[model samples]
Target chain A: GAGVSQTPSNKVTEKGKYVELRCDPISGHTALYWYRQSLGQGPEFLIYFQGTGAADDSGLPNDRFFAVRPEGSVSTLKIQRTERGDSAVYLCASSLWGTSTGELFFGEGSRLTVL
Target chain B: GESVGLHLPTLSVQEGDNSIINCAYSNSASDYFIWYKQESGKGPQFIIDIRSNMDKRQGQRVTVLLNKTVKHLSLQIAATQPGDSAVYFCAENGAESKLTFGKGITLSVRP
Candidate 1:
């Protein structure tokens, strides 16, 4: 893909339901990241991946939020037993390399509304 | 606990005027800082970035200034336009390649 791609642009799920958001990073990009943005706030870091390994997951918030990138290209963010407070836009980004100096290319984001 | 914050929550400027947005980060270890612009119903787009070694960097009609002594970062937009109306965010590269972002400042350009 020319840029980062995300699926399920919008999702409305009931409380306690499980939902998954997908992201397809640009070809040959080795670094992928996930972020969540609440209303009137900036994007918060959720997780970061270097290749197929999760280099960091400290910002996942809780045990209910999980993400995976098995192939080093596509990633998925899975939320279990979703709560109303979890309503936000989930964003995905990719970089040519997982370096601090590289700029991240962002996707359109998946808006999840937990009702 | 290191965190990033903005001095102002919102800023209103006239079109064609220069606009400046400020942000402060607590981490001194951060070596890179980036500014992003996010419009309604869209994701954040990269505006500009400055490295710790450089105090300033410039792009097309935009400039980013970094003050490592105070851990402050700022973005300047020249000749602001209506299209520049969006929420501006400052992010600092933290441990493990994570970018910690500030709350953001909403910039409104009035015609």
Candidate 2:
């Protein structure tokens, strides 16, 4: 894709349900990142992937949240036992490089609502 | 823990006026800073960025100023327009490779 792409733009699931959000980064981008944005707040870092490996996962809120980048291009953010507090806009970003100074390109994001 | 923060939650400016948004970061080691603009229902878009080595940077109609001594950063937009109404966020790169973001400020442009 020319830009980052996210799937399941909006999802409403019951508590305890499992959900998976997908992200397709721009072609040739080696750095992928996931973030969560709550109402009236900026996007919070969730995880970062350098190539096929996760370089950072400390920002993930809890064990219920997990992400994987199997091919180093497409990534999936999985949530187990969803809670109402998990509701937020999940954003995916990709950068040409994994360097600290690289600018990130973002997607529209997937809004998850746990009822 | 150190983090990036904004001074105001919201700011209103008349169309065609200049707008300034301020941010403060606590980490003294942070070397990079960026500003983002997010519209309703859309993801954040990069506006401008500045490095610790430089105090100022300019884009098409935007400017980013960094004051490392005071840990302050600001984004200045010239000729504010209705299309510029959005939430603005500031982010800084600390010891880690990830960028830490501030809560963000809503910019309302009045015609």
- What's the TM for model 1? 0.97
> lDDT per residue, candidate 1, B1-111, as tens digits?
999999999999999999999999999999989999999988889999888999999999999999989888999999999999999999988675899899999999999
Candidate 2 Cα deviation (angstroms), residue B99 = 0.7
Query: Top model by TM-score, which number?
Result: 2
Please identify model 2 stretches exceeding 4 Å from their true place. Answer: none
**lDDT for A79 (candidate 1):** 100
> Candidate 1 clash total?
0
What DockQ does each prediction reach against the true complex? 0.78, 0.78
Model 1 bad stretches (over 4 Å)? none
Interface CA RMSD of each prediction in angstroms = 1.1, 1.2
Write down the lDDT of every candidate, Cα atoms only.
0.93, 0.94
Tens digit of lDDT per residue, candidate 1, span A39-90? 9888999999999999999989999999999988899999999999999999
